[model samples]
Target: MKVKSFKYLLTSISVLILVYHLINMFIFWPEIPERIAIHFTKGEPDNWGLKYFLLVIPLIGLFLWWLIGLLTKHPEKLNYINLTEKNREKQYTMAKEIMILMQNLLFIISIFANESLLRYAAGMENGVFIFLSLFLLAVILISLFFNLIWAATLKE
Candidate 1:
């Protein structure tokens, strides 16, 4: 399969954004390592500015999955010469498999983001990081678990 045209486009955008953010975090950034100043300044916010820089991949993954779901579930009813319910169902099954995989990966990323690796976003506040991390973790886990279990609900 050609992987669908719209999916290719969305995947390309996702790769681009992911690269940009990774470069911004690892190469172009000037954050003070371990709260230690290596220059004339005291220090930075421990990479506060770049904590959430590389989160675009998950967003793009979501859009691509949605596009795949729509295309597979709603192929042109008259375009195929021998369109059958079996073929349509097969396409929908493939799309659901792919979408669930995407959802699982996204949820895993969210779980990692809830760790200290990207905890500087909310600053050094006492409960800001903990609160937001737990909230996001819960949301991603719940969404992925439920959506995967209820993939049939997406049939149209």
Candidate 2:
């Protein structure tokens, strides 16, 4: 996908997730406890806060969406592997792909985090954090593999 399209898609997804979260929060407002689990470590809640603090995920998502959109527009400003006149185009494409994937990953992670917070607030297990971590690891590995391929191709 084009960088602009990819950025817009990521932004749209983030906004949709935020809307879903807000609606879910309102739906479950009555059941939300006075104190909610806001932070976790080793799969255990370690910090507490007002239930309204649950909005933090969407807020972070919005900030990240904006940042990604801006960065994607200027891939030349990003650090690139094998950046040379001959490979600049290829490098920029690679960077755009990487940024797009990262943006999508961020959106996914935010959604999972928001859901985890809600589940924890409702006294349910927040096992998805581990799952999300694994997904992130996979994304990083895949990104590295693609970077290697692009770098090797650039040398040709």
Go through the candidates in order and give each one's C-alpha lDDT: 0.45, 0.75
Give the clashing pairs for model 2. none
TM-score of 2: 0.80
Tell me how far candidate 2 lies from the true structure as C-alpha RMSD in angstroms.
2.7
Model 2 per-residue lDDT at 51: 82
Residue lDDT tens for model 1, 6-67 = 45554565456455445545642344233421112233433233233434434554565565
- Tell me each candidate's TM-score: 0.34, 0.80
Which 10-residue span in candidate 2 carries the lowest summed lDDT? Answer: 124-133
lDDT of 1 at 140: 57
Off by over 4 Å in 1: 1-3, 27-30, 35-85, 92-156
Give the Å error, residue 105, model 2.
Answer: 1.5
Error of 2 at 122 (Å): 1.8
Candidate 2 per-residue C-alpha lDDT over 53-132 given as tens digits, one digit per residue, 9 for 90 to 100: 77777778767866886787789888766678987887888777777777767766776787778877876676766487
